[model samples]
Target: ALLDIPCYKILMGCDGKNLQETKDLYNLTDAEQELLESKRRGHALFIIGSKRLHVNFEIPAYKFSYMGKAGGR
Candidate 1:
């Protein structure tokens, strides 16, 4: 499955409060929205190829905060 594959690029430090805004801004599908909504902190995985693909995965909220503090280092 696409979700089972490891992603090449991982997007960190998403603000849960902006889930709706992010969904609206990105035109996320219902599945994506549900995935994002499931956790207070999550990261998005990107598998860019001939077809661009993305999926969200849960992470510790503190990790998200740390990523932000570290400027995504």
Candidate 2:
């Protein structure tokens, strides 16, 4: 499903546990790194190439403080 997008890269960060892997996968943009800041509990996230789209796996409102902090960047 995700492959249909016309992007040069794809990043999947499955919770905080895969931080390094995610960073290695997408080259962690500055804003992206910052988004991972308060995600101590981590989450399943999908970053399509070139900011085309971002999908954070069903996190709760309170836990998504970083999202609000960044104001959807």
Candidate 3:
């Protein structure tokens, strides 16, 4: 199900317990796996291809935006 969407940055969960799942999803290296285990709370990897960036964000792009005033029904 998660394989369909085109994602720019994928948030990799910080845990070695789920090592295989994480590896399959992100294709993490040995160094990356070590780093993943060292992550503290409120930190995660922003996976962009082979590059593992720090900042993580989710897609489907839902956020507050200013629209015109609503007309009374």
- Give the TM-scores of the predictions, in the order they appear: 0.39, 0.35, 0.48
Point out where model 3 deviates above 4 Å. 10-13, 56-73
Residue range 2-58, candidate 2, lDDT tens digits: 444555543443346576666665677666665565453434235444553444555
Ranking by TM-score: 3, 1, 2
Query: Per-residue lDDT of 1-73 in model 1, one digit per residue for the tens?
Result: 4433543544333446677676665566776676555553444534353233555565766766655765566
Q: Rate the local accuracy (lDDT) of all candidates.
A: 0.54, 0.54, 0.58
Clashing pairs in 1: none
Tens-place lDDT digits, model 3, residues 1-73: 4642545655545665576677676677787676567764445666655566765344333432233246432
Worst 10 residues of 1 by lDDT: 43-52
Cα displacement (angstroms), candidate 3, residue 60, comes to 26
Residue 32 error for model 3, in Å? 1.5
lDDT score at residue 4, model 1, on the 0-100 scale: 31
Worst 10 contiguous positions by lDDT, candidate 2: 40-49
Model 2 ranges off by over 4 Å: 1-17, 40-46, 52-73
